[model samples]
Structures are given as structure tokens and as C-alpha cells.
Target: MHVRHWENSGGNIWDKYTVKMFPQEYRDIDKIYEQALLVSNYADNAIALAEKLEKAILSLEEQPYRGAERKYGFYAFKGYRQLTVENYIIIYEVFENEKVVAVVTVKYGKSEF
Candidate 1:
């Protein structure tokens, strides 16, 4: 079966900051925002780091044996997968039925969780 992809329009507090200030910090943030919008225009578009984290998570989920190391609590969700992105980690579970990927949370560093 072909892998399906879906985008969500959810944003956290930190993500809000990224959205507000990234335009001032770096011009690349605009590009990042555009790329993310490709998934969902209304979705919470994050900075470069967040985009990187999402790409990594997607890669790992498609092939759970790639660079991602299986961690505990992964089984809590049917297709749970986690990955690190610039000191921050993103946890998400893949759902094959709806062709969607749901992000559970994005937190700073592994210790934050």
C-alpha cells in the first residue's frame, strides 16, 4: 500500500512564538513556513527545526528501522514513532487508515517529557 500523508492545523505556545518572530530572526523561516503550508495552510507552521523534526519523524515511520532507534512507550500507540530535532524531540503516531499522521506533542529536549 502507498504511504499516505496528512497535515494538521494545531499549534502550541512555542510554535506561536516561532510563527510570530521567525520572520524577524531569519528570512529562511518564510520558506519553512511555506513548505509546511504545503501540508496544511492553516496548520501550525513551525520554524526550521520543527520542520526538520517532522521530516525525520515521517521518514522513521515509513521505515521504522532506519536511523530511528525504537524507544519505550512507542507501543502505547499503534504506530508510534519519535525522533530528535535540534535538542528537541517530536512524538507522533501514524494512522494508515485515514492517510494521516497525528503529532502528539513537540517538546524541548528529551528531559522535558
Candidate 2:
């Protein structure tokens, strides 16, 4: 397969897929950070964790299908997928037409939307 986005030392990644985060996803990440702060009273650790979470999501640029289909069938879009990072689930969808993997939302793994 040919790659077109996200580069590493080995080679380029993505099947021309560009990863992007939706506004709701940003808010979800902020909520997680805020919750962490409430528990530990520190922003450093929370920030680091959030960064790592972001990296995990970016890693999906080339493997947009790495996540499984929405099992509950509650999602509006049929192409919805879920990627788990620690206790959080990153909801994303691959748009073949736009060559984009748009992160729809992020939520605690065990929680329901």
C-alpha cells in the first residue's frame, strides 16, 4: 500500500489519511485533564497523559481501521470506530473521500455516551 501522511524514520504513513480532532474531542480531553487535576491537584501529570493519549490517536492515521466498529450501534454514523487508550476511548471515523480520520470524541472507557 502507498503512504501519504505522517512520517517516521522507517517511512511515510497513512493511505493519504490526515488525522484531525473534532471540537467535541478537544472538550473531552479537557474534561479528562480537569478530572485528573481534581484527583491529584496537579496539571503536569495530567498534561503528560493527555499528550500521550493524543499520540496514540495520531498513531491511527495510518491504521484508521485499527479500532473496532461501534459495538452498541448507538452512533449516528455507521463507519464509527473506537480506539482505547488507557481508560479512555477515542471515537473516530475514516473518511475515504476526504482522506481524513476525524476524531469524534473521547470518553472514559467504561462510561456510556
Candidate 3:
């Protein structure tokens, strides 16, 4: 989805990136919501957490490179970037040629896997 536009400091318009989520991204978030619901036993709190994660993921359209590069674990040096929201970490990559920000996956921050 094309979430927003981009403008530089000098008011120069830059190409906005299209944010695309992989199927795994959706499943990862759903898992988060389910786990949250299991723990808090509150649907509203779980929904709020999921919404916050979605908002963070959508914000990438404005600045795809804002996230920190993955420097550890399996994703290290793989051109992946990570955005942390609450207890979840979002992994994505930016394809400048395509002007697309592809959300690769989401994982619980505290999980070993």
C-alpha cells in the first residue's frame, strides 16, 4: 500500500515508497494478537497491540531506511532492517529501484526462535 508522500528538507518531493507485507507478516501479527489475548485475557488490549504494530509497519512508507540494519543473528549483513514496536520486531528490506518497502516478517522480541 502507498501510505504517504515524501518531501525532503528543501521541500523537494521524492518518490514515495510502496509498502508491501508478505504473507508471513500477516501470520506473525495474528500470532502476536493471539498470544497477547492469551496472556491478558482482554481482546481490546490485544487489538491495541496489534494496531500499534500495524501503525509502525505502515510508517515505513515515509522513511523506509529509518530502521536499524540487522547486525546480529541470522539476518546479519543480509540488507535487512529492523523496526521495534512494543514487544515485537519487524524485519523489512527496501528496494530502491522498485521504490518498495517489503515487510519480511515480524517476531516477538523476547522469543528465542
Candidate 4:
């Protein structure tokens, strides 16, 4: 699976935190980055996750769950879903025909609405 982030996703993630913690947060962000890398060697693990997530979404739509769930503080639009991965939540969308997932945000845990 290949993951793709929206232009401002990374910035949105960082913006939720204090500027000073950016350095330490980078260290934390590295873990997910590694998890994504382990899944696929591609330079952008976020893309990998997006692709993986798209597959899951397709499965979900095909199977038809009781309902679709949204995480707290997630803003909704026509074609996307956002969720937390540990402390940070990445916003993403699934494109059915293309089987593509686009990540729109990569924010920290302490973010508030």
C-alpha cells in the first residue's frame, strides 16, 4: 500500500503542538514513520498507510457495517475520514475506483478543538 499526504497534513499535525516541542515531537513522530516504513520501504510511509487504509475502507463499504464511525474532533467533508494513530491522527480519504487514500493531516495527541 502507498500512502499520500495532503499538502498541509504534516503542517496541520505540527501546528497542534507547541512550537518548542516540535523537536521532541519529531522523535515521537519517527516511531509511526518507522512503522510505516516497516510496512513498505517507500520513502513516505504515510502513503503506504493511506493505501492500506483504502483497502480497508473498500472492504467496509462492500461489507456494509452497521454504521461508519468518526473519531472526536474530526471535520467532515465529502470524501474523507480522519483517525488517530497513537498520539497523532492522520486525515485521509478513500477513492473507490482508484483504491487510493489521501492523508490530509498528521497532528499530535494533545490537540483540542
How many steric overlaps are in each model, in order? 1, 0, 0, 8
lDDT of 4: 0.44
Write the residue-wise lDDT of candidate 4 on 61-89 in tens digits.
Answer: 33322123334565554455655444455
Top candidate by TM-score: 3
Local error of candidate 2 at residue 48 (angstroms): 2.8
Candidate 4 residue pairs in backbone clash = 2-47, 2-48, 3-46, 3-47, 3-48, 4-47, 13-106, 13-107
Candidate 2 lands at a TM-score of 0.79
Pairs of residues clashing in candidate 2: none
Give candidate 3's root-mean-square deviation (CA, Å). 3.7
lDDT per residue for candidate 3 within 7-86, as digits (tens), equals 43552245567788767778889999999999999999999999999888777877789999988777778999999999
**TM-score of every candidate:** 0.39, 0.79, 0.85, 0.35
**Pairs in steric clash, model 3:** none
What tens digits encode model 1's per-residue C-alpha lDDT throughout 1-113? 22334333564322221111112223333444555568556556445545676466555434433334335554343455665666555555544444344455554454534
lDDT of each: 0.46, 0.78, 0.83, 0.44
Q: List model 2 lDDT by residue over 3-69, tens digit each.
A: 2256655545435478887677778899999997888888897888799788878787767788888
How big is the positional error of residue 87 in model 1, measured in Å on the Cα after superposition?
0.8
